[model samples]
Target: MESGRWDELERRVAALEAAAGRPAGPGEKDPTAPATFWALEGLRPQAQGSGAVVYAGTFRSEAGEVDWQYAHHVDDLLGAPDAVAGVDEGADRGDLAQVAARLAALGHPARLAILAAVLRGHDRTADLAELLNLGTSGQVYHHVKALTTAGWLRPAARGQVAVPAERVIPLLVAMGVSS
Candidate 1:
């Protein structure tokens, strides 16, 4: 892009920061430009009369002024270092591995659909089979075994299967459904 266009983008980002009530960081940038969106740090403070420092990132959505859709991305960008730094390697690895395994298990669309149905209170193998269009209870059980083995899913009290609370965020993050 031309320098003029870059400057304009910066201006728009700055406007977004002002509207967002806080300064923009790397994550606030457009997801399309992942590099710029996550690399901005150590911004100089706003000039004394400016109220607050505001750095521009990128425009995400047009539904409203200065789309806030990328706010969480910004937060995650900022928090990543600290999150990694503070990790209890031992404690976290267990969860991390579990999360990774679970995520991998649900990586397929069929498995993901089945898991979603389970999370939504579908329990019995018959129901899951019906929801997923699987031919038999055995097929649903086989897939459920895959998820349960990885700790990505479990059977709820009422015989409904659900994702464990602790695993929800990782699942969403893995699925790119959440930041």
Candidate 2:
């Protein structure tokens, strides 16, 4: 890229950052920060300002082994406005610990499979055990306890377990089971 284009890109990113109310200093933190859209390599701003921005950019895989170019609207990229809105900036250590625990609960393959089974309507403990081919019901319940304690699963009426309604889409999206 030419110097002029690079400078323009930097200026635009700065403007976008400013408009989004991001703090200027490196160590400064904002409790209620808005979503930040990266102007990745080869990104071209299509339209900006007016409470929204559009860009043509490459979405790179984690390993940088693949890249897909697509035009993206910033709002759409951030997901549902209501979902992203009103986020508390004052999240403390306890909040972070809870998040870490929740993520850790999904780290095990058996736990992930169990969650997937529940998502697919296999809510019974015996059914989940059979689906995963575990040796005993105790093992299934152990994983179930982890998931339930992490707030991913809840006991339904009878002996079945379920993913809470509000968590269904978020969990599936996190697991890459849904877009």
Candidate 3:
């Protein structure tokens, strides 16, 4: 790439990263570059003025594979970070409450184990109980209900469940980022 193009790419990546509230790693390539951070770049316009939080990933497990990408306007996702410029108190109360509720649903260790287990093909209540050593199907059912109501998991074939295709990347990103 020419020096000018490289510089432009770097600037865009920086903008995207800054909007994402992520720190740049050493030797970080330009996210705005093609096949790199296409989601971020595509969201750049909608994320304009208010910025955006974007994440994407591909996951292959015993269950199968998931290729996903997602973006949320910063105003919709980050009202409490207090670090991003222009993040005022103007964020929608309902959205923050909903996001908080969803995060709260994922706050339990057993719940996370349930999600990880389901992602790995242990989608049945009994399979999840056995795989996670939860001791009882009732305990597994409690977590399943929470995850399902939170939209992290959904009903599938009889007696099984699945993480919706759209939530896959976000769920992984949430776990990975928090860890």
Candidate 4:
């Protein structure tokens, strides 16, 4: 990483630590980041039986930046006694079939290409077809429809399409892990 980039990151860390009523300095616990995995530490106590998992990160793109963290104790999915308290009865709960449907939507090569193109600023169906050399605009629309229904992409102004901001990191992370 460049020195300037590190400097900017340190500055941001200093600002965050200052807000948290701590000082940022070398050899001291980074106030901006916990000395340990805060998410894992929190999950370990409550996650029981089948165990738990967590995924989180900061993502940057041409469109914008996103900070995200998510965790699920397997007990929660199975409604075990160890589940998180106050979960809505009507909550999606990431049931197996629903998650499979969403994952299936990204299984297509064309859909993945469309998502990648849109993230890189080519949001138009025609542009995506041309840029990715996938197929006709109609076929692009087909892929776009699947992505939209899966909540991975959305219809934008002037017939363009976009990945919703919250979905951006997940999409990139999914793609990265698959690769």
Candidate 5:
């Protein structure tokens, strides 16, 4: 949604909260939270009992309207080894901080190009500089340092750089670079 419209909606929600004499605190329930929570709360018993439970909700604002559905299945994968492999339902402040830092490191186009070059086997500083048409190796090193600090790259044998094994797929996915 457009920023202007989102801002307007935020203002409206704040106004509503103030009128209700319960101004929301930081990290408090969002504008739609009360209604959504009420709706879900009403379904708690049914959701706790049986098969898959589905809840459909809709939110309308001056900015836009969103219709969403949530499905819950209790212990659907209790014994599955990989059930929680990539699930991140609740991340703490430190996890979010690290994620923010890593994403910031990839915010630059040059850093992305450097990562791409490394993925394509141009792992040396000189090779990356030549491939990216960077004026000097220093520029290439600068981007490399950012990526390395973000845990996206590490030193290999000799003076070459390499994407850590576990990060290779995630890095490509982040860059939207197809295999």
Candidate 6:
């Protein structure tokens, strides 16, 4: 609203545009940005440093939409936009926590043995129960539920279960079946 405020915003936006390898001009599109980047029309820049501007806003695309975002110093968006890396700051840590919780579910020897058995194509719960000497379909089912909830196992079909594809590699690596 104030004169300095607009100037500050402009300076910040210019630095961000430069860092992102975009030429500065109102309505001039960023050539390096993703095809969907122009959807960032409402972006308002905020200066984070003397030569750095953080363009923070939402981006819309067919993949859906991302909100509360930032585009930082990057040479090109033709690659990946150089933004914050790793787990997003606002991501549901609940999912990350799920990994450890899943590991804990698999921590039991009986469960681990069952997962190994299932992963080996012994899809029948009864078959796994017999292999583990755990006895009965009910006991195996209980352990199976634990692994399933943790995403370590999934129902391959009715009356049959299997490990998820993503978990297969990790399971094999944990069991030393993979290199």
Clashing residue pairs in candidate 5 are none
TM-score of 2: 0.49
Candidate 3 per-residue lDDT over residues 1-179, each given as its tens digit: 89999999999988897888674478875465456666666787777547888787898877678888777776556555543344554455555767778899999999999998888878887788888898799999999999999999999988899999888989988898898
Error of 3 at 135 (Å): 1.7
Instruction: Report the lDDT of model 3 for residue 86.
Output: 40
Any residue pairs clashing in model 4, and if so which?
none
lDDT of 4 by residue, 115-135 (tens): 888888888777888899977
lDDT of 5 by residue, 1-179 (tens): 99999999999988887788684588876563457566656666666534444445443433244455556564441322233453443344345557779889989889888877776677877778778888798988888888899999998877798877656655655565432
Candidate 6 lands at a TM-score of 0.45
Across residues 70-130, which tens digit of lDDT does each residue of candidate 6 receive? Answer: 4443222222222234334333344445556876886788988887677556788767777
TM-score: the better of candidates 4 and 6? 4
Worst 10 residues of 5 by lDDT: 75-84
The CA lDDT at 71 in model 2 is 47
**Residue 137 in model 1: shift from native, Å?**
0.9
Clashing pairs in 2: 31-89
Query: In model 4, how large is the Cα lDDT of residue 29?
Result: 74
Q: Which stretches of candidate 2 lie over 4 Å from their true place?
A: 1-91, 177-179
Q: Using TM-score as the measure, which candidate wins?
A: 3
TM-score of 1: 0.44
lDDT of each: 0.59, 0.69, 0.82, 0.80, 0.69, 0.64
Highest lDDT: which candidate?
Answer: 3
Clash statistics: count for each candidate: 2, 1, 0, 0, 0, 0
Clashing pairs in 6: none
Span of ten consecutive residues with least summed lDDT in model 6: 74-83
Q: List, residue by residue over 63-131, the lDDT tens digit for candidate 1.
A: 222321111233332333434566555544454555567667876677888866655556666688877
| Cα lDDT, model 6, residue 174 | 50
Looking at candidate 1, the ten consecutive residues that score lowest on lDDT are 62-71
